[model samples]
Target chain A: MAQVINKRIILKNYVNGFPKESDMLLNASATIRLNLPEASNAVLVKNLYLSCDPYMQFRMRESKAGSFTPGSPIQGFGVAKVLDSRHSNFKKGDFVWGLTGWEEYSVINTVGFLFKIEHTDVPLSYYTGILGMQGITAYAGFNVICAPKKGEYVFVSAAAGAVGQLVGQFAKLSGCYVVGSAGSKEKVDMLKNKCGFDEAFNYKEEQDLDAALKRYFPNGIDIFFDNVGGKMLEAVLLNMRFSGRITACGMISQYNLEQEEGVRNLYQIIVKGVQIQGLIANNYLHMFPKYMEMIIPLIKQGKICYMEDIAEGLESAPAALVGLFSGRNVGKQVVAVARE
Target chain B: MAQVINKRIILKNYVNGFPKESDMLLNASATIRLNLPEASNAVLVKNLYLSCDPYMQFRMRESKAGSFTPGSPIQGFGVAKVLDSRHSNFKKGDFVWGLTGWEEYSVINTVGFLFKIEHTDVPLSYYTGILGMQGITAYAGFNVICAPKKGEYVFVSAAAGAVGQLVGQFAKLSGCYVVGSAGSKEKVDMLKNKCGFDEAFNYKEEQDLDAALKRYFPNGIDIFFDNVGGKMLEAVLLNMRFSGRITACGMISQYNLEQEEGVRNLYQIIVKGVQIQGLIANNYLHMFPKYMEMIIPLIKQGKICYMEDIAEGLESAPAALVGLFSGRNVGKQVVAVARE
Candidate 1:
């Protein structure tokens, strides 16, 4: 048996509110055995890219069911290559993406969740975003939940981020008039130019979100792909058209708050006969094969585009993850743990 | 042609917030011609039962659409008898139910919305409730929006009121464990004993609505027929089960408030993967024929029961309508303006 150095990011404590970089610790001194245990079904893999998602913020809190324990390596979605495998489904040379540890190498006992990479012609880092959970989230939220019709008005918040950018593009492909809102001017430009949205705005600059929504969606919003869920959601509720659909994918704005902002205009949902539904990507995993079948060709044809804000090493993971809340990332934020 | 003195309840001014008896005037000096005009497709009717519904509160305010004009007669759903007719669908001596004025006699020009009563075996006042808009509201909200399954947990707020009482019975008929919340002890008792709810609670007595909900529904609410939308709605959001459905019928609690209460726990809708939908009975009018077919049998067989708090004469119409805000009426409130 041989020993190898493993760099990891560990949780310092159960997070109370907005997570700071100091709440996580970076350790390069930990060591792991290169050899696997006999008769075990685990696979040992070297992580290449780790995804920073808003839902991961919930895992840092003190929840009885799914929260990350203090002093443990924070777990998230990542792209990895198997170094060794005792599982029949995976091999030493197989590249995969799934739930993995925030370290250089992880012994993954969770065999069912791991998916072996089939298409490698595109960027391998995309396995963390476009080919993984984020892709399926955009697919299910827009296509399945919203069920948008052509020429409908579609609005997306956090529209420059991973799932939102794709949702805007999908809306356009469906012949919908799509508008998106981002935090910065650069991100807003990226939304309109790169993501193919009909219009985009810097929500941070708008003093009155209701007036902003009215200006953009003069006809009223038919489908709202909501990522942020505070005052923005409240404003969107007022401007929604009759029989509108709202896909409540993530409430990134409320996740870090001590007390979430109260939404006042929910009464409007009744007057308009709207349907607001919540969705989780994990529940729609069965649709991944269908999603890849639809999305892979779009990516190959340049009809779909994706962007990643990559940090250099495992040491940059804490800052990269924390940046998501403040809208520092231009697109999907990922940490490059190692190069193949 | 003879002239008749028709007493009416007229709006004194455009109401801003909670309505008072003084906001409406009892006009007994107004007179109408007993004869219909030649070549006019209108029916002159004597109002028998004027339904006092919660939605009428919105009409008292100054709105661009649907609000009552100052110095005009208050409009509402009512059961009436045709004293004279120039319309082919209705003739003299025909009993009908539709939108009519809150007066002793009204010349109805809109015949399309009016339905001629076919079953006179039941009380004519039943046309104001179980056989009319309120019946269809409960049918559409519970059966259409909620789409509940057997053995599921169902919750109704304002549970002894017009639509709420019917919704509880419908949920029970669907083999669900139904719980209802009312403002008073008598109403709570009526929900459990008369409406056949599995359990009932006086919301005024329960300081912690969430805890009360937890006590009744240890599993979690599968369907929530929301009538009181302020704090009760906020509490129900926390106790909903995964993929639960909520029918946003009426927000009686919020209607009279100058500034409606803000709902804080809406984030729970996302965590539970619930669907909250708004409904208007008018949109589902096509389903009316089918609704009556289903409900008439239930009413005939004594499987369905209804209660009405009837006020004597047109003089009490203002107080009866205003009483709905304070939960003063025990059941479906109606004003007996005249005998058919």
Candidate 2:
């Protein structure tokens, strides 16, 4: 078997509050076999793109289950091409996307989360974002959980991030009036001008979130796609209309806090007859085929626009992942490791 | 026209913190005609049994919408006899349960909330609790919202209260292992010994709510019918099982507070894929006939036990309404005004 240098990003320690690039170390001299072992059932792949998601922050924390182990390569959703395979479902040279390591090559044993990429007409890097985990998350969380109706008023928090940007677009496609909140003025401009949102605001600049929400959604929000939880969620609660739906997709704001901030306006939920639901993408993976059927045409027709912030190499993975916390990346953050 | 003195419980002023008996006054001098005016289209109901509900507290506050006007009789759900009717739906001598005033005689203008009682086999006072507003609330919150499955672990806050007790019994009927939390040992005893709950705990006795929940529900709670929100809700969020359902029925704990307590463990909601929905009885009134179809049979077969704490006469209404905040009234609090 041919051996190759597999550059990897390994966890140095379990992160406490606010993940730092120092917590992860890039190992450039690690070597791996290009082919799978004869008796092994795992598939060997060359990683093409690694996705940086806010949910990965949870895995970096000290946890008994689902936490990243120290001295090991961190795992995340990635686009890859199979170098060798002993599994019947996957073959050599097949492009796929699923849970893979932040390394040049990964030997994947569990095939449950993995999916073969069918359409090559679009960008392969999209498999790490719009056509992958984040895509399914936005589709299910917005369409299914929200059950939004035409002419409804929609509000999305962290609206420049991977899932939030898509949810805002989905809301517009559903014939709804949509407003979004991001961290920076550039992100707000991108949301309004590029993504076709009715209005967008920089949440960091707003001293009173409640007043900002009221100004954007004067009639009150009918569906709230919450990417940043904590204070934003509380503000949204106060501004929600009767029978409003809230999708609790991610709490990026509170993920780094030692003690998560308390939400005080929950009483508004009862007053407005609101529904708050937490969504996990894995649960909605069955809808991927349906999602592709809708999204592919929208992309081809130029009806849908997806923005990606691409990091240059595997060495940039740590900064790309850490930048997510401080709102450094404008859209879906993907690290380009190898083109083919 | 025959004139009659209508004894009424009038709000003297808007309550700020905890409501006191002095906040309301018994207006015994008020008089009204026993018959409806020639041109007026309304139902004149003789209030028989007045219900003391926690939700009425919201109406006592100074609000632009749905707040009770000062110097007017406080309104609640009650079983009434129609003395005169100008409305086509209701007629004289008809028994009804709906939103009526806390008074001896009420000329109800809006017949939208009113419902004509079909069966007379059960006690009329039952209409104030199990067979009326609270009954429909518990049924819709548990059966429809929670969607309970057999062998699921169920928990109810304010478990000894009117709606809470019924929800526990409904959980038992669904073959779920139910646990209840009340304020006193007496209520806890009633929950376990009388209501068929698997376990019952006096929350006041336990300093740490998370520890208490862990001790009772080691496997984690699958369905949580929350009546008293605030701290208990925060604790329940930590102990919820994956895909757990929570019905945000009534937040009696925070209703009187100047600032409602903030819930800190909402991240657990996303971690567990939990769903929290608010329940207002008016929203689910469309399901009342369906609820009656289920509950009436259960009541007839003695499969359901509804406990009521009767406060004699209309004079006791003020104290009875105030007692709810203190958990002073066990089970359903009903004021027996006129039996005939």
Candidate 3:
């Protein structure tokens, strides 16, 4: 085994709009020894699941402060097994999830971000979606952003994706009439049956989104977790209840559009007296432990269903990422960069 | 004077698209009883000066729930002397300003709306702006919506208008380096001199708005009070700091346009972590007295300069309102419907 072997996934070039497989390349050499000195104050971990998010598309671009450095392996949230540690807080054989490098072996200098996984009895892969950033995002956005009432009409877009699926379920448990929009019929069914959404729609077949929203939510949307912005958001604006709240967590639909789609019916926000705000999971990290406490029981009782589309081995990482933009993955798109 | 007179103004077939003076007809000989029963809780007042705003243009068109009913005299904020009072809250010789109908005399049923003027030491016209909806709006939206911190970059669109002018001054007093956009160089001058804006620009002359904002706010925008929300909004979106707040009080530029102008950079909101919120001043009615306490002193000390373009007579009301679309008014556009 080589002492300094690097398994890297480099961004091919600056992505303009929608990213393709051509934008990423996996460069690997061999295995490496995992060791850290007492003074190192660092942890050596074996990478497990690497999250493939649409926001990564932003990192792949060339900018003064792009999310990640181009021509380098993109690093993001992932689950890992600690191989060796000199940090007082971490120990060998401990499982963790945080900002791990997108490689087989990583030397994490900061342990402040990493959190030890206590409930390993559940699916370890759940850290990639339901038990991780996605879950926290959905929770904080729903509870904090909207202060959703029990009988509120909840609508989630990109409803089959990592965050959307959980939001729909949370809304259901809170007694909301939940409706979600997905790209495929299969995803829509998963939302209705598995995610416990009251109603689901395949937005692709929706002739007019305003009319579709009206038919699904005859009254109006009270809590809108806006994952996809553009025409859908414009339509949702028209269908919002008085004093409605729109939590803009992400806008996957508009992420790659060269020209932003125009929202014609935004004036409704004025008359409807709606409040729209954006949310980031990072800012709400203080609520993570409480989130797990709240979510673990739901998972054990099968009240909150978790989903993932896992690609095996580091070699499949590039294809797995590109598949996200094309909606090739069924649920939480992830790659097993390494096996413990 | 003919009884049952029609000093009323007609909506004139919804004005089709942009409003014109011809769209409204004001007939005289309209009169109503100067008194109501004590239990009626209504007050009869002679309208002295009515505030003409662009938002009233929205009420001109037939809308869902008949927001601005057609064939009705345009209604807005006004300074009125109480001729007779049936409500304990009001008395004869007292002045008030709230939602007064645009006519010579109004029998306002002070059931839920209407606030009596407690101070007449300042201009009675101040009831239409500095002490009325305009002032409270400026307070809540800028103070609460933007939640601005000292030294942060603030950008105000339509900065010479009723609300924007006050917001800019408040931001400056809060130690923010404020930059405001108006339609003319004269209006721009008013912002720098009267409003104490750090920088001002006539957006119409700027070939590149993004560049203009960058030049004025080199550090990037922390707060944006968006009164004109079309191209200026898109430009501000590009220049926003992370966690920036935008208070969307009005979008006068896009209000009357047959088609809403397309925003090509809304996705920047997600990337920059900006929050754009629509605000209705009435939601913060509980904070109105607090608003008066804060602003009355500023007005008395002459530290804050308020601007108004007064159009004489009720007959000129229609033109004064239509003038807003073309930026014809130099300051807060208003019409003196009558004089005591």
Candidate 4:
């Protein structure tokens, strides 16, 4: 077997506050063995689409045992093709999506989460977002946690992001009156025009979020899909109707803050009898098959839509991941590591 | 039928901040007709035990239409005996419990919520606390919302008050380890010694609530029945375990503040996968019969306990109501206007 040159993106050190492209070092010197080690369950993959998710920022910091290690290639959800496999479930040329490194090639030891991609009709890059972890996150958070009803008012923060975009669309499909908030006019326009949101607002331009919410949802919000927590969550709390549900998917705004902003209107939770719940997509993996059953048909029928901001090449991985924190990406950010 | 002099407590005006005894004025000149008008569904009752609750503070302020009107008799849940009735469901000498004015006598037009006291085996005053709205508040907030499993760690704030005390008892009966927080040492002693809480602490005496919660809930809190929100809620958020449930019953600490204190640790809701829900006991009225079925046996068997801080007369109503904010009264605060 011929020796393949493996280009990898490795973190220089544990990050402090906002990450930068300079924090990562692109190495082209690393090489991988084409042959698998004897009896090992590991599967060697050629990475295709590397996901740049907001949660990857949490792993970059020095945390407990499970957090990403410094001087190692950062790991995240990605779409890849199996080149060699010692694992019984996966074979050569198997298209899969699971946890992988920001590199051209990755030796994956855990094959439990690696799902063999069956559908190839749509874009393979969709597995990095709408068909993978981010897809399940939006699905479970909106459908399971928020439990949207027809004609109910729904508000989603970070509405142009991967999970937020899907949640807004799901609410719309459920016959809900969906409104979304983004950081910029372009993203806000994308939400309204492209994502089919009933209304969208640039949160940065709004002087008072409470007034903005009151305007969008005159009857008060029934479901709040919160991606950016802190001040927006506080405002949403004030505007929640009786028995309103809040799906706390991510807190992108407060993740980097040393001291997170205090929510002042939590008392309204009692006043309105609201339920605010936090969710992680991994916990709801059992519902993935059911979720795919619902979403796959929608994709085929053109009843649903998704947007992506693809950055070409393995070297662009660092900048793509860093761009997520600053709201620099327009949609689902992905790094195209390889052609196939 | 003769005219009866009614000694009533009237709101001087819509209160701006923390209420004082002077904020309520005693009007002794007002009178009520002992006889019912033709075709009237009104029931004239002699008020006995009037319950003073923390939520009453919200009604005291000049807010929306539901708030207590200025220059009107202050109304609340109370135990009363029907002296005269034009309603088909009730006759003279029937013992009932429902919303009634804070006065010596009241003519209640709406008797829908007025539950006829069938189980008088217990004290009539029990209807104002253990067997009344406060009891149901604890039952619904704990059993319905928290949904505790046996041996789960339960933490209750304001744990010696009307709702908190009952919640602690319910958690204990479910085979859970219960801890409670109070403002005074005596109440703390009452929580552990009388209410059967495994542990109790005086939050006022503690220098750091986060440290206190960390020390008590070393394994983290599974269920938190919050009566006093704000800072304690922030601390509890930090100490919550995975999939923890929080019942947001009240925010007594923040109610009087010009600006409610901000909860800085709301991001923990995501970190720990917590579900924090607010409950208005009135919405769970359908569960009252089931709650009573579970509670009546506990009371009759002497398996459950309750405490009352009783005020002597109608004149004491203002002080008793005001005392709740200051944590002056122990257990359920009740004003005994007249004995049955």
Candidate 5:
């Protein structure tokens, strides 16, 4: 077996408040064998596209159940190619996506989270977002949890992000009057003009969120896909119509805060007979086959569009992940570590 | 047709913060006709037991949709006897329970809310609590929304009150480990001893609500029937189990505040895959018959017990309603206007 240098990004230390690019270090000292050890059940993978998500911040905190360990290769959802496999379910040349390390090459012992990529016609990098975990999150949160009906008013916060973008598109496909809010004008314009949202706004420009929501949804929002929690959630509670539903996906707004912002107007839930349902994409992964079946055709037909912010190399992974909090990424942030 | 004095309790002015007894005035000058006018589609009722509910606080605010009008008789769920009727559904002397004025007699123009009282085997006052909106609220929120399973841990805030008490009993009946929080030692004891709750605590005495909940629900709460929102709801969020269900039945704690207390820890909803559903008992009225079928047998078999804090006379109605905010009432607060 030939030895190869493995370049990787490791968590420098546990994060406090917002994460910084310096919190991670690119290490090129590690080396790995091209072949797996005899009798080992581990699968060796060459990482391709690494996802930079809001949830990755949670893992950067001090080690708990799911938190990333200091000095360990920070793990996230990524698209990878199997170089060698001692596992029965996978083989060489197999493309996959799931929880993988922020590295050029790695040996995965835990094969439970990994999924074999069946459809590669629509860009393998799509496995990092629209065709992967982010896609299922938006699908399950909007279509499954909220159960959006035709002609219903829908509002999506963090609407230009990976999950939010897909949620807005899904809501529109459900025949809903979809409105999205983003941080920048470019993202807002992209949401409205590019992604086919009925309306989109730059939340930073709005002084009063409640008034902004009311202006967009005068009759009141029937469904709210909340990717950013805190003030936006409080404001959405005020504008919710009777029996409205809110899907709690990621709280990107409060993830870095030492103390979470208190959500006022929860009483509106009772008054308007609303439902706030929490969503975890992993729980809905069983629907991946069905989701791909529905979404792939939509992508091919131009009914669904996805935007990506690709950072060129493995070294740029830390900055790409950190940029998510400051709203620096225009779309789905991905660090392309290798071509194959 | 003959005229008779109709002594009533009228809203003196729109309430601010917590309601005061002075907010209501005893109006004895008004009189009503003993007979219905020709072609009138109304039912004239002699008011009996008036229910003192937490939601009445919302109606006490300035006239809006579903708000009480100043100088007009307050309206609420109550048991009454039809003195005269031009509505085909009712005849003279028909016992009914629904929305009625806080008065000796009321001429109801809208008879849609009223339901004919079929069984008088139990106390007629039960119609104001166990057999009316509160009963259905407990049933729909617990059985339908929370969907309790055997061995699940359940927590109810305001557990000694109208709906909470019933919910605790129902949870117990469904083979759940039920815990309840009240404001007084007497109410706590009653919840555990009489209501069949596994545990009960006085929330007023617990300085750290999150600690109190952690102590009670060490394994995390599977179902939370929330009546008193605010800090309690926030604390409950921290202790929710994976896929936990929270039914937002009421927010009595935040009702009186001009500005609602912000509920922190909403992010837990996503972290734990929890669902917080808002419940309006009216929306679940279709389940009333099924609920009554399940409950009537339980009540007859002594499997369910309800506690009542009866306030004698229409004069005591104002005080009874005000007392709910301060936790003065030990159980289901009811005003005895006239015992038929």
Candidate 6:
């Protein structure tokens, strides 16, 4: 066997407030053999790309869901090439995207959230977002929960975020009049221009979200795909028509706070007959095969598009993640650790 | 044709605050003919029982959903016997339940929210409640929206209100461990004895609702059918477990206030994966037939229960409605204008 090498980023401490660089630590871990042991259901693989998601911050905290152990390496989604495998579903040369450690190499136990990339005609990096967990979140939330109908009024918050952008596009494709909100002027323009939202607004510039939403949706929102919940959510609640639906995917605004913002108008939910649902993408992995069928064709046909902000090496991973909170990353923040 | 009679109650003016006796004026005006023109699709009926709901107060004020015309008799749910009809659905002696004038007799348009009373074996007053909108509201909100499961911790606020009492019983029948909160000691006792809540509390005595809820639900709430919103709903949001669902049927606490109370811990909806849905009974009319099928058996078997705070005469309707704001009424507050 050749000399083994592994470089991993471990969660240094359980984060108390908003995560900081001090919350994580980079360490050189003992390497594993590039060959799998007999009868072991493990895949020895070289990670080609890793995804940086906001939900990862939750794993850094010591909560009910599996947390990153104080001294263990952080885990996330990644695209990798199998160097050796003992699982029947995968071969040594197979390109896969699943749960892998944040390192140069990984020995993935065949347990949870693993998928082999079947159709590789498109960019393999697409698996990180538009064809993966994030993609299914938009599809399931929009199609199943929201049930967006033709000519319905749809609003998407965090319109420039990975999931929001796709949700807007999908709503538009479904014949909805879609609008979105973002934190940046550039994102607003990008949403209206490239993402094809009927209208887009920079939340930073709007003094009142209710007025902002009203200006865009004159008839009021029938569906709201919420990502940055807080005042935006309160305002959306006020403007929902009779029988509106809100898909609560993430609340990036309150994740790191010692205290979060209060919603002043939830009574409007009762008065307006609204349905707000919370969803976790991990719970939606079973829809992957159907999701690929819908999204892949959309990407190939250029009916749907996603912009990715690709960082070049392992060192840039921290900045990419932290940048999400600061509105620094333009689109999906992904790290390209190595080229296949 | 027999001499027409129309005993009516008209709003004296739009109530600026909680309704009072001075806000309404009752008149035993000349009643109208029961027979509609043969060419018309209208049903002329003699009003037997009228429903008094909190939402009717909104119709008293001017807004988007237009207020009832000032001099016209107040409109509400009623059980009536069709004296004459041009409508295909109604004929002489047919008992029906629908939106009719809040008086002795009414000429109802055939278009919306009218149903033939198929089963009259039980007390006809039940159609004003368990067989009517009140029962349907509880059935759709708790069973369908909240999706309560056996052994799930279910909490209901305003648990002695018209809809809430039934929702609590529905949760109990579902094998859920149900807890209900009422404003008075009498109501707390009634919630346990009459409504069959697994546990009951007087929210008026509890200094901290979150703590009270925690004491009742140590494992945390798996479902909350929120009838009283504002601060109590906020507390419920904080205590919800992962995948918990809240079906919001009303927010009585905030209804009459000039400014609604704000919710302080809404961020928990995303973190705990709780779903808060606001529902209107009107949209679920398609399920009404099925709703009756489930409710009738429950009522017949003594597996379900309800309560009513009946005002003796139409002159007392205004006082009963205003009493809802102050938690004066036990169970549903309905007025009996006439016996037949």
Chain B only, TM-score of each candidate: 0.98, 0.98, 0.94, 0.98, 0.97, 0.96
User: Over the stretch B202-297, how does candidate 3's per-residue lDDT look in tens digits?
Assistant: 998999999988888888999999898888888888898888988888888787677887676767766666777788888888998788888889
TM-score of the first chain alone, every candidate: 0.98, 0.98, 0.95, 0.98, 0.98, 0.96
Q: What are the RMSDs of all candidates, in order?
A: 1.5, 1.4, 2.6, 1.1, 1.3, 2.9
Assess each model's interface with DockQ, reporting 2 decimals per model. Answer: 0.79, 0.84, 0.54, 0.89, 0.90, 0.66
Model 5 C-alpha lDDT per residue in residues A77-176, reported as the tens digit of each score: 9999999999999999999988899999979999998999988788899999999889989989999998889999999999999999999999888999
Give the C-alpha miss distance for residue B93 in model 4, angstroms: 1.1
Candidate 2 on A126-239: residue-level lDDT in tens? 998889988999999999999989999999999999998999999999999999999999999999999999999998899999999989888999999998899999999999
Per-prediction fnat values? 0.80, 0.79, 0.51, 0.92, 0.88, 0.74
List candidate 3 segments past 4 Å from native. A1-14, A22-28, A37-39, A66-72, A110-112, A337-339, B1-13, B31-41, B66-72, B109-111
lDDT leader: 2
| Residue-wise C-alpha lDDT for candidate 1, range B1-340, written one tens digit per residue | 8798999999999987778999999988999998798889999999999999988888998888999988989999999999999989999999999999999999999888899999888889988998999999999999988888999999999989999999999998999999999989899889888889999999999889999999999898999999889888888988999999999998888876766678888888889889999997888988988998998888889998798999999999999988998999998999998887
TM-score, each model?
A: 0.97, 0.98, 0.94, 0.98, 0.98, 0.91
iRMS per model in Å: 0.9, 0.7, 1.8, 0.7, 0.6, 1.4
lDDT of 5 at A20: 95
What DockQ does predicted model 3 obtain?
0.54
| Candidate achieving higher TM-score, 2 or 6 | 2
Superior by TM-score: candidate 1 or candidate 3: 1
Docking class of 3: medium
lDDT of 4: 0.91
**Regions of candidate 4 where Cα sits further than 4 Å from its true position:** none
Residue by residue across A1-340, what tens digits does model 3's lDDT show? 3487778787767888877877788787645677876679899998888988888887777777845777767788899999899987889999998888888888899887798998998878788778888988999888767788889999999999999988998888888999999999899989888878899999999899999999999999998999989888888988999889888888888777767786666667666778777787778778888888899998898777888899998778888888888788888988987756
Candidate 5 versus the native: TM-score? 0.98
Q: TM-score of the candidate numbered 3? A: 0.94
